[model samples]
Target chain A: MLKFTEDHEWVRVEGEIGTVGISDYAQEQLGDVVFVELPDIGKTIAKGDEAAVVESVKAASEVYAPVEGEVTQVNEALNDNPGLINSDAQGDGWFLKIKVTDASQLEALMDEAAYKAYVEGLG
Target chain B: MSQDHDVQDLKRTPLHGLHLSLGGKMVPFAGYDMPVQYPSGILKEHLHTRDAAGLFDVSHMGQAALVGPDVAAALETLVPGDIQALGHGRMRYTQLTNEAGGILDDLMVTKLADDRLWLVVNAACKVNDFALIEGALDGRASLERAEDRALLALQGPKAADVLSRLAPDAATLPFMTMAELDVAGTPALVSRSGYTGEDGYEISVAADDAEDLAKLLLAQDAVAPIGLGARDSLRLEAGLCLYGHDIDEATTPVEAALVWSISKRRRAEGGFPGAETIQRQLADGPQRRRVGIRPDGKAPAREGTPIMKDGQAIGTVTSGGFGPTVSGPVAMGYVETAHAAADTEIDLEVRGKALPGRTAKLPFVPQRYYRG
Candidate 1:
């Protein structure tokens, strides 16, 4: 199941492992993604902590960790092709994979239907 | 009530409604609610301006006219440009300086007549600029702030062709020259100069008639409304200095690589403010200088990014961003004199990492000004 954070990050969970990336809405607002600084593998992060940076033509934004976990891997292909975030923000553009520290944290996030309504409220 | 007051406090230009109608994304800039980009986005807006004509509403800029028999002479005391020698219909780029040789503001002075001169200054510095000019020239000349006038720029390679349709005489005016003409039945002061490096004209019209004139210009097939986002990127690619960012009260013209604007006569006579320090820097190099920076990779080194030489911090980027025309990242910053030379290798600290870059000659894209 995929859960979204208020900060616009999304995580898809399978067993104890979760894949993290920014939402399509976030990528659309950021314009063309020129570069991304991914967190190092094996680094532990707490929920809501700044874990990555995404730079566009005009500005840069920080992406936060939605749930506490230890990073296991990062998308190495982003170094050469950051535009993937604009093209496929949720799937191939996954920023990192981590082992969830607490499964109960997922319940606190918004599901797809709720996330859509939340984004509409912002508009 | 305070929130309502805040909204009312933000000034609006005459073209505000037009921008909204065109799908412009409004944002607060220099206390004005201005359009940063349109539905086309900044990238497309930037590229479009390079290839075709772009109409920009610069009504927020401060415009004024100095009228007096000795207006030019009086103006010279505040700025470093050769205003007295400026021929009628010619414009000169200059800066207001302080006692310490630092720039107060960069502005354009146009000689409209022997006893009258026109001025255009940055939006953010206008209030202070007007007060300084008025205070300095009080007894010698009268400064009339043109708050009732609105300024617009038609820029890009196709600007002349599109504008000439209305004011046939505008095409003959050489670069840096101005003329009083009629556009769409409204009287205007048209100058063949602009912030963009492309051939263009800045037209000053009555505030009440601004929207009508804009509608007429937008009717041209070659012209499109451009926002502040593209304006910034265009100026950056053209190697122009943005007053508050690339230059401020702490920087002198010589250090900003704008010594060319200081005419040979002004350099020799040295009567303007801060002449002593400026002359000294002209003879001997300044401690720091502004230069173009080209980052090696895709990541743009933004403003406040530290420039390092062999692990030692030397300077910081003042204006840095992606150049849509160059198809890569480009920036400008002040660096220690030792690292100011073209082709000098340096590292830019971005997000706690060092990115390789090299000093480059300005105007990442060659200027296309219509000199003739």
Candidate 2:
């Protein structure tokens, strides 16, 4: 199951863990990702905490954790090729995986169809 | 209502339609709707400008002329640059200083003729600058504001070949020189100068003809429309100062490392505003000095980032970002003169972490200005 936040972060729930990354619309707004700072593994983050940073050619933005969890792993490929977010924001661009401590918080987020409608409303 | 007011306040350039047609991502810049990037993105546009030619709008920048029998001498009262020595068709880059030795704005002055001088200033500073000059001149020189003219910059190595195809005389124009000529049937004041360190030309044409002229130029094989994003990166890599960031009302020419712009004759004569303070700084030394900085990592140290030297705050970065040409993070800021030398060890505090860096010499990329 995939859940989205109003801040444009998306998480894919797989069993007790979830893969997190920014949405395609968010990547489009931040043109040409230049660098990314990943959160350390074993770090416990609260919901909506700044878990990582994404730097584009123009400015930098914080990628927040959509739900509380312990960071189990961070994407190492992003260290050398941060543009993966611009190229593949959904799959290969996954920022990190966290062991969801509060899976109930995921229910507060929007689904794919709801997220699409929400983005359109932003226009 | 405020959002509506903000949109209503935005001024559009003559090339606005062209930018939209070319898929430009327009954003507010200095109260104008300007493109920050195109579909090609900033990295590609920056590299394209360095490798070939790039066309920039720049129509929002302020342009005006000063007319009087003794224009140069009269204008010299506000700036520290030597105006009396400028020959016909020559230009000088100088700053307008306040009475306290702080910079009001940086501008380019061109000696068009004995009785007339052309002025190009930053867009954001133009309104206040024109008013300041009008009040200070007090009939000594008349300010002829050109709110109707549009400016365009064609920059890079292939800029000459692309422009010469329209005006053959452009090929022989010397650096820092301006001439009134007919470009592709449109009359223009073309200067062989630009913010980018590349050999280029800045053309001042009638606002009504800007679109047609830009289209004509972009039709060339080597020319592509560049946005403010790449223009910023190009100037950053070139180590040129952006008015408000690298210099402002709080920074002086000496502190900004722009003493070279203050001519030797003016330094001795000392007739301009803030002359007393500037002269003192020139004789002694500035408290701090501006220098180029290259972080040893991929993280960029942006504006307001603290510069640390041995756990103590030494300075702050004013302008910084990823330099496409340098292939890494590049920044510039003022530091204690002791730690301002090239290759001086330093640390930049980005996101509360101290990043190792060094004070590098200016112009992270070698300047390729075509003197001939």
Q: How close is candidate 1 to the true structure, as a TM-score?
A: 0.94
| Residue pairs with backbone atoms closer than 3 Å in model 1 (clashes) | none
Model 1: CA > 4 A from native: A70-84, A91-94, B1-6
Query: TM-score for every candidate vs. truth?
Result: 0.94, 0.98
Poorly placed runs, candidate 2 (over 4 Å)? B1-5
Kindly state the fnat score of candidate 2.
0.52
lDDT digits (tens) for residues B277-368 of candidate 2: 88998999988999999999999889888999999999999999999999889999999988988999999999989999999999999888
lDDT (C-alpha) at residue B163 in model 1: 87
Report lDDT (Cα) of residue B48, candidate 2: 98
Report the CAPRI category for model 2. Answer: medium
Error of 2 at B42 (Å): 0.8
DockQ of each: 0.38, 0.54
Q: Which pairs in model 2 have colliding backbones?
A: none
Cα error, residue B254 of model 1, in Å, equals 1.0
Instruction: Give the candidate number with the greatest TM-score.
Output: 2
Each candidate's lDDT (Cα)? 0.91, 0.94
